[model samples]
Target: MLRSCCFRCFGRRNGDGLLWHMDLKPHASGDFSIAVVQANSSLEDQSQVFTSPSATYVGVYDGHGGPEASRFVNRHLFPYLHKFSKEQGGLSPDVIKKAFNATEEDFTRLVKRSMPVKPQIASVGSCCLVGAISDGELYVANLGDSRAVLGRRGFDGEKSLVAERLSTDHNVSCENVRKEVEALHPDDSHIVVYCRGVWRIKGIIQVSRSIGDVYLKKPEFHRDPVFQQYGNFVPMKRPVLTAEPSIVTRKLIPQDLFLIFASDGLWEHLSDEAAVQIVSKYPRAGIAKRLVAAALQEAAKKREVRYKDIKKIERGIRRHFHDDITVVVIYLDHHKSSSKPNHKQGTAGCITPPVDIFSYNSDEAVENSGDKIFPNEESRSRVAY
Candidate 1:
């Protein structure tokens, strides 16, 4: 039987300025949890949680160039999502897409207003990952390289569990992604290049899809003061980047156990199987924090430092070892839900909540302009665990 529960059981916790956590709560599988750790000089990651008797929403946002873009999305995206859901009378792909479009358009307008004063704003961008569970369905959507992995049981056997990825990564390091960029701009032979063993677009950004980075999406931002640092190229052309998202929808079943939603930072030190293994073997409460701790321990191993020692390192300096990492583990409850396989769900969930998402597999040598790829992370797509 698929266990379901009302979203009201959420609990929240904060770690240092660089770390924060949310313990288990009512979720599609059972209980849900989340955690975030800052490794950047300034926290470039943002996250959100919304739960009710009927639905739950999770987001992880990884900002690059600056925190402005992520903060903006954190403050605005959820409201837009709620608005679209209400207008459409329920959550659907159209509503989710509209929510993303609204957020992208809003951020673009903000850039048009600020770029004259802050040229670098045009360069700021964020990878967004969102997961929404309503009724008996689960919806996962992404822009950039963030990832979502599902853990399930009763597959190989009742006691055996596995990890299944649920999102598409837009990082150019993937040959398919590189081919995609080339196909999108067949005229540009140098659209994607291999540098430092990493693949990048236009020899700069690694992500081909994102919420901001107006400098890439608009020719207007390609010239002068704003994008001067982005380097000069031919004049007048179509966009160099896109904000559209890749989406996946599925019916939640009894075998589905939990999900691990995280930023590229975590992927740097962990694998889908490893992550699912950890989750399957541990307790549900604070599972997200446990994942972060596991990743940090792995990061320390690369530097040959003790995990305790690594935890003592401060933010700005710590970034040398790891990127900003954020994780949310949603433990689905198939045991408590009063609903059956065909039963209707309750009407719950509020429109007000913080929404942020970022996940990637960076174990590969990746190349993106401006941002240096530290040898600590990797990125990937969604697959059924």
Candidate 2:
């Protein structure tokens, strides 16, 4: 049996700007399930939920620059992915790849039209990872560094985290990425200078694959200069840097445990294995909250702040850990119980109404939408007595 929960918590440093949300539901004759967790640096993260008798669609976009790009994908990606899938008549590997590429192009165009004032939103981009699971098949499309790792239960009943690496990191340091960068700066000794050889233009930005940031992709800006001093050397055209992402897919089995979709900040402090160990020990809904708490605690420890004064220690923590942190945990099994059931089913009755479960939305239609149906929301919101 397997059980799951979708829980999230935003640290104080992120202010009210951080947006985190998750949607999970059963699909394909209840043989498969779909879950999506999205987090952003601003409260502008948006998502669309579509439910079909046979499948559920979910996509997450972590926006940068401003919340608009993230919000745009959240609102549009799933619909487009579904359309692409339908056109292909199924969720084949080729369809998934085309959908990702098409979505990226669509997203780029939409953003440009939506925000005519490029400078106001200039340099803003986003890391997007889209996953569609249907009939034991999982299709993933990604841009930027936001990642998805699969966790599985071993023979011993212990969980193991395996990074299937659905997407490639788009930064400039990769051989292909370096070539792209060098194409732009052929005359420069350093191709996108950084702290050490360890950092290149590709690695420095951290997110190798992404949408937007037209400034970085401009040939004139990133291409190396072609020097022809004193008419001694022949002139040549330099190459330009690029930040294109890769698409990946795999067949899933019941043995596949869970997945962690998160930003680099949370991953910075923990490994996939460490994250699995921690979440496997607790219920799924509490995983994200606990992960955030752990990260804050780790940040606090680094600053030597007393537990009692953790609130007052924000400045110190921010100084050492500046990036906004976000985490989304998706458990594969839906039947596993984290604790014993209590007789009291709240003041209402044995059946917990959908409205009572997800109080986040006021609209009844929004609540009943199959995409927002999360069995763990109500139970996870309460503090264990």
Candidate 3:
């Protein structure tokens, strides 16, 4: 019944920019479920999960500035992961690191190729978080603010679930991350700056590590036309930021009940403990959707608006409230023997298929008669939810 606990509402697909929460669906891992909710007019978050007999992989990619970096990672990261996975005859820490490095290296190549034609490409980047399970070990690697939290129960008559954060957040909002950036650039006192009540690198981007943002990582791209709002520009000899991910390895144990992997948007509204408690208390089926809904409600509360009113607002306009939220919850199977591996299931070599969750806003606009103008294609009459 846990796997069957999905939120269900029927609405056929359409070309409009709106997208409702996806109903929960299983991956190759029979125990896990994934769902996503898009809030941005142009969705910038991308995520995927793949399971094979030997391994399970989950990715949460959050794009900033634009969608190119996230989209590129969604298309290529897993393939590179699969390539190294097969080459090594299994998954390993080195393999995951290489996959990330290769993906970063490849995206830089893309930025170089496009910079001449589209100067804006230099600024786009994505925060990368990947979770891999193999050979009884769980490997979590992250480059940005996305997080992975484990819900664990004690085997020694413990009745409650405990939240264990697995991924390291690289956002400047964390004091340690700011220290890390400052350590990297000892000579540059202004490397990490505090501005508008938030810490940022050079008073610009918040995350200290990421996959793209060639403009910040590579000195050559900085001279090009950057976003005007992010002025006071200074060039550096070495990269201002990095693509290296902080990876942690743990032996997967039976006590581990489930894992919550989500973008920062969800965390902006919900804490790790709050999320784990929800999963522990609720049926597993549509929990990801539930988490997303919770985040939206929190966002609405902060804006002092009714949830129903927020729901009625269109995508582009919704940006002022919240961000694109993506969540994947994987419940570990207790019935299976913890000592054994799932080798018999075969290599889960297939990268989850790419999804076009983001739609560009069309130039055409709709006028609300005696009201505000909006997109006419957003026909509320046709959507059931």
Candidate 4:
């Protein structure tokens, strides 16, 4: 049972305030499972989970900004998803989309309430990429640039990777983003010039979509007002205020082998085929840790960090890496049997209501069981071994 593999490796760098963490907890009925991975940057790449009984196989979250945002999401987001699913009935793509939006709203509200006086903290935000598997179906939701790619084993004994982008970036360079920004700052040519060519809003921020950044969602700033006048009502712009992720769903065929969820930091340095090749060579858990180690090693090598300079070693490591790197490799094995009836060979099943594996009373049993499963720092520190 893979049960989900999550490890956070920090590079030796100044201002490397990235965080990566994950959690995998069995459902109340002990039949299904949920997993989450959060990372602040590419250097702090995260990993996914593959559990047994094969109920609900995978769920992942890739985070950006500083470590706080990623850490906060890693701790809070999955719980909200569970709660939302319980209330909404099952984990359809629609249910997952609703949960993602609600979670982001709640997270933003919570951050605003907690940091009422600190305006700087309001600017801090992170990108999110999520994937959820329920009742043999896969649902993906994304915010920012982190990606989820599925690799399926083919009949000819070959494997091909299929990438389905679930979220849209909020950067001003996007056509829709450009149109929106132009509406706001019609008079500001510099903003348009900076955003158009470099794909940055103010010449610094690369991503247009993310969590947090309440400050950027304000009116009288950007180009057009963040809040638009809707007749007698003023409505907040979708990109600025809403974290509702774009959702995509697909049936899980037996040939589906694995998935890779990684931040842009890692993807920027490595291609999709190269990344999948690295993970496909190993088993699930081993591949997860190896991917993190490989990213760190690559960052270190690129920065030219000298092995002899003990004092500057961390600095060297950090110099080569400005952002956190998180990678999650989810190994999907369909050979195992599930409680559901099998479809004919080569034919994937149609999307139907998700099967309920747990009854109402199962919640009480889950609570009473009191099984805790997350790695402590000491255990995670040994990742290099």
Candidate 5:
């Protein structure tokens, strides 16, 4: 049923640019919508949604410096989650943490291995945010500033939904985050610095926790000749950024209407309440795309430009107005029967965008040139959704 539904409904691209969206699709607990708009020259943001009869996993990775780190996470994180969940017999906070750490370590090793040929991998990193639902329980794990927000009804018989943030932001812009970083390195007065009107760790990166950014985390990488070419390299006695995620777990109830998982691109322009209220008042179909449009509209308004004009600008130039945005809106359906198994039994069917959206414009083209476009078998299969 899930496969037939996906084949019939089909994911579609919007306009001529880098935007892609899936109107609506069924997951274990309910329905979900996904949308992504690329702004960077190479599309640094990567996202995926995996659904099955008993579980659903959502990931949004917002990359910086390069797309390699985010793409690596996209390729490795979920499998690691699945591997650990299977070995441990179930998903838990420890399982999720292990997945994150495993992915981070693997990426670090990749950077090390590729340094001889592609030394820039050391500078690439991404913010990872994951929302996983299993057996009526919800788990939110996050590193960096990407967010997951829960929309639920009020406790006193109220009809309106309340916005509750489920993940912690690790960006140094927050006072608490800066203090945490400073407290970790008391002797380094410049551990967190105010530069270019924003707080950054070592005046280099805003996120204090992430999967990569190996140059900031490894002293050996910091001393590498390749990293030194970036200018103003700050020496650190220890790793400044961490792969550890701030994890939160909760039991899903009927009152939990839906969840909005998005990158900082959407949050920078739209507030949590605004995003949740839009989903609450709008149609389920294309709600994720609608939220992205709302954020883009706000981004346009801030610059005194029309939304149409903003859409006209090419990828790299568009980054000046807004970063790459990825949104997944998961609606809870407590009344739905969970006993029915999915088409592949309990295995999740994955839905993900191509590594580079700018390269492919249509579903037909992507399907026709799957091997040329995706290159890797795992990548090709992942985008089949």
Candidate 6:
């Protein structure tokens, strides 16, 4: 059975408010920490870690426009990964891409089914970042701006750790991403325009690749009524967004210390180097929460308010100060003896935070929202001991 990391159960509340976290947990390679803070009416960020004796999987889904896409991905993406990996005999770039494509296709089908009742579903989308580790190899895949960063020991016998980016952000805020979008849609003079003080695709969205955003991808869903609720919708001859993910794979070495997987919310206030430094300087336990706290402090500073005051702010109002932030820190135990077992022997399972931070009954919500694993599949995967 999948384990729900509810505050009332294995996890703990960071404070009396919207922050919740898992201080530390053991994975196949080593330990991991997870933390999340809500800033949206409904939490738009969903994340999880699945571990086994042979492999580990990590994902952070940062939703926009609505939480539906992220939540959907949080539920289905891993299972698809497991299914395809099993069929393909092992994990590979092709397997990861196939799983992504399958998830995108399935979500589009879901939107089609829900359109009659919920036309707004077409506009919801999520940034996806995934990291898989197997046999001392790491694979990072991403869409939109969520990031996976490696904190590695310095080269040339230096003592400090270095921050190495593992995923490419696909948001149009970057000049290169803007150029890529423009090159793809040269016919559309306004493919990307400066709006609301930042660059946005078609003046509506920022990310050029994501799991959802059907209205921008399918012409049939581009009518006025389809996007009437969301003004500033632009008509396009072709898809302005894609589900394709940029992927990177690397063989792990002793120099690789840890991995930081987080949504753009944390990256907005903290640089890759700063985040790695935090991880390098702090204790392993609660390190993810520490990162979240640091980012919140920076967010508060930007708004010229006290951190305590921001903590008192409610979710929707709090979003003005910061987006829903999620951070997962995975440590690689290179020092572990090679003869030792990869992971503790136990039933295979997964660990994920409560679906929504602000839910009145998080335990109940988590119980109802436990992940669905593929049928008859068994791999000794778990995040916590």
Highest lDDT against the true fold, candidate: 5
Give the count of colliding residue pairs in each prediction: 45, 20, 3, 25, 0, 4
- Model 3 per-residue lDDT tens digits across residues 213-274: 88888776776554333433556767888998899999988778889999999999999999
Q: For every model shown, what is its TM-score relative to the native structure?
A: 0.82, 0.63, 0.83, 0.62, 0.90, 0.91
* Candidate closer to the true structure by lDDT (higher is better), 4 or 6: 6
Ranking by lDDT: 5, 6, 1, 3, 4, 2
Q: Quote the lDDT for 185 in model 6.
A: 89
Please give, for residues 1-385, the per-residue lDDT of candidate 5 as tens digits: 3222211123688663678889998887778999888888777888888887788989999999888888789878888888899999999999999999999999999888878777777889999999999988899999999999999988886656799999999999999999999999999999888889998888888999998999888888878887677534667889999999999999998889999999999999999999999999999999999999999999999999999999888878989999999999999988763567656445557887766666554344543432231233343234421
Question: What lDDT would each prediction earn against the true structure?
Answer: 0.74, 0.47, 0.73, 0.47, 0.84, 0.83
Output the number of the TM-score-best candidate: 6
The residue pairs in collision within model 3 are 5-285, 5-286, 52-348
Question: Worst lDDT window (10 residues) for model 3?
Answer: 365-374
Q: Which stretches of candidate 1 lie over 4 Å from their true place?
A: 1-17, 27-29, 154-159, 224-236, 339-385
Q: What does candidate 5 score on TM?
A: 0.90
Angstrom error at residue 118, model 4: 2.5
What CA RMSD would you report for each candidate? 9.8, 11.0, 7.5, 11.1, 4.8, 6.2
17: Cα error in model 3, Å: 8.1
lDDT digits (tens) for residues 126-217 of candidate 4? 67777767677777777677777766655564545444344455556567877766676656554444644576654545666666554556
Off by over 4 Å in 3: 1-24, 27-29, 155-159, 225-233, 337-385
Model 2, 150-243: lDDT tens per residue?
A: 7775546453544444555555545676565566566766545566655555333545566554445543222222211111222224322333
What is residue 219's positional error in candidate 4, in angstroms? Answer: 3.7
Give the per-residue lDDT digits (tens) of candidate 6, residues 177-281. 999999998899899999999999978888999999988898877674645654445678899999999999999998899999999999999999999999999
Residue-wise C-alpha lDDT for candidate 1, range 53-104, written one tens digit per residue: 6677888888998777886776667778888898899999999999899999
Model 5 residue 73 CA deviation (Å) reads 0.5
For candidate 5, give the lDDT of residue 156: 81
Candidate 3 lDDT score relative to the true structure: 0.73
